[model samples]
Target: MSTILVTGGTGTLGVPLVERLRALGHEVRVLSRRSPTHPVDLREGTGLDAAMAGAEVVVHCASAPRGGDDVAAGHLIRAARRSGTVTNVVYVSIVGVDVVPLGYYRTKLAVERLLEGSGLGFTILRTTQFHDLLARVVGAAAKLPVVPLPSGVRVQPIAVEEVADRLAELAVPTPAGRVPDLGGPEVRTLAQWGRVYLAATGGRRRVVPLPLAGKAYAGFRRGGNLAPGRAVGRITFEEFLARRDRTGA
Candidate 1:
């Protein structure tokens, strides 16, 4: 079995991808700042070489939720380049990173550039927002008596588990640049999603649409963030809500 290193193995997408790799009989190394098994800091380049050594594939799923994704990507690139055995560096990125003016998206785009410039075999999988992330957004909005949503914004939210399966497949293959973007089964506006969420969680809130002004809104309005042509995910938003309700998660 090939040795695989999974950075951010404990993250939203990383966790399931790691599990899938392991189940497929690939030896999995999980990079974690806390865990001694593969403790490494990509931001500081600390212990990164040690973590990546002897790993044939590096699935980079780690990110700072709030910010600093670019720095983290840099650390991973440096480490992977140092590991001579590393053949493919797989990065999970957002679909609209290239077009989105948001800081987080910009960092993701930066990482893609880093991987490309390194002259190493790499595969970048750009996916739509995960169901979990969308759910969290709704959960936060549910806290308010009036739920605020962006108007003219629709998202194709995919299941993290499905994304995990795809990542594992990509890791086992030769590197490809920015593979087909992955998206959910359906596209729905933020307002539509909010209503379904409120219904699922037994919450009542007035849904108000905000006609925001900004590049972010403009990009979203134009569907720059979605890859309808690459809609590979099978799980629907309603199914995600049903699962969430069943699990109380």
Candidate 2:
């Protein structure tokens, strides 16, 4: 029964989130710089107030996926403060925001800080790497005679849909602060995950283990981004591949 404003509505997370909210009987409006004309670029602070006019919840999911000018969550926090009508600001963050050694992760952590100090009802749901990304990694790694696996890397990847559902749930309620980390049901090594993907795709490839060095590689190899004992997703990686197979893409 709440009207929710979803930023980055055309992006990976935003598209599905808006659909879920609309399906659940909530009035949904998508904020973007291009389509739908609600033009609120969190990085620039434009069109935010207009989008927030009647929104009770704002799901801020408009971060750069890989490359950008690097605006932290603090920017959105300031925009929310200016809107002054948002009841809860639910932020979509990665599971290793606190443990990973990457620039994007650092930005996420800084944004979390901004949310904590913004004095508004807020929630942060930390999730693992998306399943689609796993497919990409697997496709790339399986190209060689033997898959070069990162030793000791433990990952529990979740479907994007599951993460979106969790965000939708958080959007409708009062901020629960930092919620439980959402992860896939089972954990797998980097090589095993890659193999599963290749096998599912009916591709011929051998799996080989590789010891990755450096801080970022070490962090990933040491299970820095997974949450095994926390929130478990319903979809399995194999099941996800099966679905993709049905679509024949």
Candidate 3:
């Protein structure tokens, strides 16, 4: 078994990734801003060198949800090169990030470019939105009397577990640059997702579809980020909703 370091090893996807890696019998080290075992702040490069020191395969799962994915990726790439110990760098990225106009998606795309140019053995696995994350967004919006959704926006949400499994599979070997995208089994409109969430959580709210303008909305409306042909995830949104209330499946 090799030493695999998982960044953001405590997040929605990270948690499951770590569990899966350990079950596979690899010596797993988790890197996070607050990880007690291997705390590392990719933003500051704090403890990153040590955390990455002996890692054979490093799964890059952490992200600055607010932005700065490029900066974080730069820091990790530099640190990994300096260590000269890491052989493969596997990254978990968002599908459609290259074409999406959102700020976070731009950051993700920037990170992909950075990795592509880094010359390090790396595999960037782009996946669709996680079901849990969508639920959180809908749950937050449910607090309002009217839950507003962008009209005609379709989403293919995959289970975090599935994303984790893919990351583990990619991390175990030498890097294959820009692997195929992963997505949910079914594609549904954003409003459809909201309805599923509202029904699953028993939250009552009026879903208001509003026309959204902007490059981001336009791209989303056009499905610029979707990879229908690469939809490998088996779990449907409905099945995910059935297990949503349960903690950490």
Candidate 4:
């Protein structure tokens, strides 16, 4: 069994990935800022090398959407290089990160480049936005009397468990650089997603289309963040909502 270390092991994606890895008989070491055993902050790099020791694979799932992802990736790369035992670094990236023009997407792309040149075996899996994220966006917008959405933007929301499954399959000793993108079963506009969210949560609000400016919004409008050709995820957004409702989560 390979000794694997997972950054952000307590996160939405990392938790399921770690569970799957442990079920597969891998010795999973969870590295997080608040981890009791491996309290390592990726942004600062403290205790990272110690936590990475003897780890054959490192699944990088930790990310900061507000900023600082590049700094964390740099610290992870340096710590992995110092460990000498870590052979593979599997990264989960967002689809269309190269073309999205969003700050977070740009940071993700930069991290991918850093991994490519880190002189270590690496694999990258780019996936569409998660169902949870889409719900959060719609939920937040629904709070206002008039929910404003981008004029022409569609999203393919995938299940986090399905993504975790794919990541676990890639967290092996061998590295497969830049695998095929994974997308949700359906592609729907933001309006459609918003309607669905309202129906699920019993929310009633007026939804308006707001034409957004800037390259990032333009990229979103152009479907740069979608992978229609690679809609392999099984769970639809409705199904995700139903499950959440059942669990009261």
lDDT of 1 at 157: 94
The global C-alpha lDDT for each of the candidates, from Candidate 1 onward, is 0.87, 0.81, 0.85, 0.93
Q: Which portions of model 2 miss their true places by more than 4 Å?
A: 67-72
**TM-score sort, best first:** 4, 1, 3, 2
Model 1 scores a TM of 0.96
Q: Which RMSD values do the candidates have, in order?
A: 1.2, 1.9, 1.6, 0.8
Query: After superposing candidate 4, which stretches have Cα over 4 Å from the reference?
Result: none
lDDT of 3 by residue, 85-150 (tens): 887889888888878789989888888888888878889898888888877777777789999887
Off by over 4 Å in 3: 246-249
Clashing pairs in 2: none
TM-score of each: 0.96, 0.92, 0.94, 0.98
In angstroms, the error of model 2 at 13 is 2.0
Model 1 lDDT on a 0 to 1 scale: 0.87
lDDT of 2 at 70: 40
Write down the worst ten-residue block by lDDT for model 2.
67-76
* Per-residue C-alpha lDDT of model 4 across residues 1-249, encoded as one tens digit per residue: 899999888999999999999999999999987888899988888999889888899999999999998999999999999999988999999999999899999999999999999999999999999999999999899999988887789999999999999999999999898999999999999988999999988988988878889999999998999999999999999999999999998
Give residue 70's error in model 3 in angstroms.
Answer: 1.6
Encode model 2's per-residue lDDT on 1-249: one tens digit a residue. Answer: 998888778887788999999999998889878856576776776777777776778888888757442463565666677776777989888888788787878778877877888898899888888888888787788887877877788788898899898898898747789988888888898888887988898887778878868888878876889898874798998998999899874
Task: Estimate, for each residue in 1-249, the C-alpha lDDT of model 1 and write its tens digit.
Answer: 789999889888888898899999999999888977878877787888888878889988988868888888887887778888889999999999888788788888988999999888999999999999999887798799899989889989999999999998999647888788888888999989999889888888988888999897898999988989988899887898898778876
